[model samples]
Target: MNSGAPSSGLDTEGLYRVSGNKADQENIQLLFDKDHTVDFRSLGISVHSVTGALKSFFTALPEPLIPYEQQKSLADAVGIENEKDMITALQDVVKKLPQIHYDVFKFIITHLHRVYQHNQNNKMTSENLSICFWPTLMKPNFTDMASITATLVSRTPIQPFILHCPTIFRSRLEPNSFLQPAEGKLIDIEAEPGNL
Candidate 1:
């Protein structure tokens, strides 16, 4: 295997030497370090609301009746006029919560494009660079994944690369299985296309 110091144009100090051959994992560690200046944006909901929602869902008594006042407030929050409308609204909120979180995460990640570009101009030493991304198991939004991939692919110094995605079971499986070109062909492929 080839090994050398990453090009001076890349933020070698920021890049952590991850154990596995996965770029996504390494990138995550690099970006999330406490000292890293990068900022993250999450869903706007308050911590109190999130905690309250969880508590209300898990701790409610069996066959419990919804307190009239609490039910009315929930209805108002969701823009519902009656009990049945409230149930539908609540269900919709529950269903959309995960999606909202993902959108927020994607927004934060997309903002990293500026950092990546800055690194490319100042620290890039190699003719080729690699980036890895792993789809979260909770809810995979193809649009967000595609957006992140597209942003990276559009950058310069095209080179041979690998994107390793672990199975939900954590099995190694096939390295080529989750890999694909960052742009061009719309279809998702198992590995980098020959052009890359």
Candidate 2:
């Protein structure tokens, strides 16, 4: 994701709000399927294409990124009224995530937070990003009113989770960690992309 999103991505007004060309996104997806490591620039892939591919990847996962069993727990955590309690409850829910899910969630949320920081150009605030990602991250069974209500409320967490990532996932994001916010650097869009 970092490979194709640096210079142009920062200035993209809609960012994830817009869709990439279908053909271009499909090509990127094929490349990813063949090999996890893809050179985005070699194929002249656009940032939108990369972002689209990312969404596709998550959507195609056997289980939603947040997982079915944990959705209610996450929603309940987000519903906490107190700020500190909310963060604490959120942390507990996050701790229960599968390792791979937790890692990917942390990485993506962290990246989105950084993007939100440059919203003057990208215009993708945490709220906008949360809205965009809510469906992709989890899909709740809307079998009943309670489940529907819980899922609707669960959407609230995506924004706060992205904004308060450091506080919520402090243990996973230790000093000098790869997921550390300070470690983030701009990807040179002009340069050849690296493998994931």
Candidate 3:
């Protein structure tokens, strides 16, 4: 998807913000289900369709990329005072993800970081991408009504999480990876009342 996005979707105004044609997304999903090797550009698949399928794949997972028990840990790690400690804490939590989850998380975050790097064209900074992704990445463990309400009211601050990702996953990132250093000044979610 990242490979195709540069030529086809990265320059689009809203890469992941807009929905793709349902038929295109379904077709892509069907190909994926059949385990066929897909070349989105060759198939003339819309970038939005590819993105939609990517997100749908995550949402359909039996367990979210961030496991149920660890969601709060990730959120708490983001709330730590010191930036280095925060990165360490996040890394610790991420290290515990099942191997497949870790790999997929790394790939998805790297892809999103690439999309963010092209924000001038796509208009999707880490924050906007987080808004589109957090629910699927960090799902609630409970199914009961009370827990659901609590989960809704106190969701993870995925924007800050994404912003700190470069440091958090430094060891796992590739040398030429788009997961370059995050913004020079990390947003203090608590300090920034406007962000809250």
Q: lDDT tens string, model 3, 1-196?
A: 2333434365567887889888988888787678655555566666777678777778888877777767767767767779889788878888988888887787677667656767998899887898788877765557744335436544545665567666777877655444544365322111111100
TM-score of 1: 0.20
Better of 2 and 3 by TM-score: 2
Against the correct fold, how does model 3 do in TM-score?
Answer: 0.77
Strongest candidate by TM-score: 2
- Candidate 2, RMSD to the unseen true structure: 3.6
* Model 1 Cα shift for residue 122 (angstroms): 7.3
Error in Å for residue 82 of model 2: 1.6
Two-way lDDT contest, 2 vs 3, winner: 2
TM-score of each: 0.20, 0.85, 0.77
Clash pairs for candidate 2? none
Local distance difference test values of all predictions, in order: 0.27, 0.74, 0.67
* lDDT tens readout by residue for model 1, 166-189: 111122123332222235421221
- List the candidate 2 regions with Cα displacement exceeding 4 Å: 1-3, 144-147, 174-176, 181-196
lDDT of 2 at 188: 30
Query: Which ten contiguous residues of candidate 1 have the minimum total lDDT?
Result: 157-166
